[model samples]
Target: MSKKNEVSFFDGKGLRNDGRRLDELRPIELEVGVLDNASGSALIRQGGNRILVGVFGPREIHPKHLALPNRATLRCRYHMAPFSVEDRKHPAPSRRETEISKVIREALEPVVFTEYYPRTTIDVYIEVLEANGGTRCSGITAASLALADAGVPMRDLVVACASGKVGGKIVLDLNDFEDKYGEADMPVAILPHLDRVLLLQMDGNLTPKEFHEALDLAIEGSKRIYEMQKKALRDSYPIPDEPQEEEVVEVEK
Candidate 1:
């Protein structure tokens, strides 16, 4: 087997190249109702990644055949702009985009009360204006806020974060450089109030012990992000009772 490249991800001072501690998450900024036209919208900036999500629906499905008979069909599209990354990508949807879209949808479906709006459709559009790494997790975080902004009936808010192993140490929230060279990446999503796992995906290898550590770190990061999500929503509209999914206020923005 070929030898792994020798790269220094952490400095002698125990800080990563980005100057963050192993268990520290990158900076995050969130905004709600950024788009005036959409039923609901949210923008998130996590590290160097920027993702915007717009939610539309609980409205009638376009083609009659696509609508679910018993519950609302959740349709999601995750698209990264051609200029979003270092290397310019094509405008068309790539295979990775397709996969992430499906992943986001599945992660979100469990919380939405689709049964409330039978035969309707809830459409979510995620636009990645920039990507450094961990866009999938960031996307889920923003999408959940957008759904709340749209006043969709949901059992709870979903939040996500990623942790990985780099340089033989597990770290929280991998950046692009670390993800590209790191030994492993695990992105996790959960319903904070419900304490249920909505999504968990891993790439690369880790020992059972390392896996548990990484999962714990990711959950910690997600809980922090969840607080921000609630704050952003509250800033836009009053949150009478948080995590009490039934109290979601319908935002007109």
Candidate 2:
């Protein structure tokens, strides 16, 4: 990685520090409903990065006191694959992952209709198959898709994106180099339907006006991603043909 903050690295002849243009996004690929065992599942590919998300039942609750009297419990787990990073990751959950999981759970709770399944709990699992710069935001995006695919009622689709300043230029959807050396990074989860924000995190430094500009850029990037999520879901599950019944006739001689 470069120094703490430098945009000179992005001077790759009109391309980003990572060789991508300012308006360009990493190539994205998606598949939904991949795990039949789970209520809903999705796999997302954004360039070399991959993430899988699983949604499991509003089933009976455990550790009962945590359960709310009026609503079901929402549980979220975010973990990295052992081989997700350049170095093998430890099997046990890291403090960073745990903190991310906690924050994601909070961001998702308001969108989920937990009240409908009182005394129950729904598990949202995110596994990072590969790592890029924006894994957490990717996890948020995948988890929301999995929940929606599972037929869970939600108020709106949550889309997440990260923005940062590189070489004195504010950019949307940062990549590895930009994030590692960024002056400021703002990651956010936005409700595309309602034009609202749920989760927002900032790292590094920026002026208040610059922060507002970064926030707006993040929201704009998220909206575009939200559209892709909707398209992925629609493509994954086509309308099933009507069931066919076997015709019965007299036994053959």
Candidate 3:
């Protein structure tokens, strides 16, 4: 590795390149109801990543053979635009995209009340407008919000976060540079209200102790994000204030 790459992840003060503490996440912003055409849509920006998710259906599933007998089948597509990264990605879906799509579908399936809409399909589309790292986790986060915005009944919202080891220490929400050169990266998703783990995937190696630490950190980060997700949904529907009673209207009449 070049000298710059060697010391690129951390400094003598034990802070990451972006000046975040070991357990600190990148700044996150989330919004819902962004796409007018979709039944439900959401967007999330975390660090340098930008992801949009749109949810459509509990609509009839064409190719009837694919329909579930007793529950709605969930389909997810995760795609990155050609300009999403430094090197333009191919427009065609890659093996990685295929795998992440499946991962996101599974991660969300548990929370959805598919039984209520049997013989239908719930389609989730995740588009990565930009990527800096941890796109899978970010995609899951936004996709769940889109599902809620679409008015899909669910047990609870799903939230996700990632943790990894860099420069001999674990860190929360690894950016692209740390993820590329760090020792390990683990992304986790969960149903926050039910306290259920929906998805956990790790890339790279970590000791048993380090793995536990990373998992705990990621979970904490996810819970924090869960609060933000709730706020975004709440903001979309502002409760109208009650109208004030007119005073002395009888005198005017």
**Candidate 2 per-residue C-alpha lDDT over 1-253 given as tens digits, one digit per residue, 9 for 90 to 100:** 4544333746647678567776566787778899989999899887677999999988877888778888889999999999999899997999999999998998899999988998889999999999888888888989999999888889987888888787777888887767877677778998888877889998888888889888888888888888899999999867655442222223322
Each model's lDDT: 0.93, 0.85, 0.93
Per-residue lDDT of 24-134 in model 1, one digit per residue for the tens?
989999999999888999999999999999999989999999988899999999999999997898989999999999999999999999999999999999999999999
Rank ordering of all candidates by TM-score, starting from the highest: 3, 1, 2
Query: Which segments of candidate 1 are over 4 A away from where they belong?
Result: 1-4, 238-253
lDDT of 3 by residue, 1-253 (tens): 5763556687789788999999998999999999999999999999999999999998999889999899999999999999999998998999999999999999999899999999999999999999999999999999999999999999999999999888778899999998988889999998887888999999998999999999999999999999999999999998765442344555567
Give TM-scores for every candidate, taking all chains together and pairing residue i with residue i: 0.92, 0.90, 0.93
Identify the superior model by TM-score, candidate 1 or candidate 3.
Answer: 3
Span of ten consecutive residues with least summed lDDT in model 3: 242-251
RMSD of each: 6.6, 4.1, 2.8
**Decoy 3 TM-score against native:** 0.93
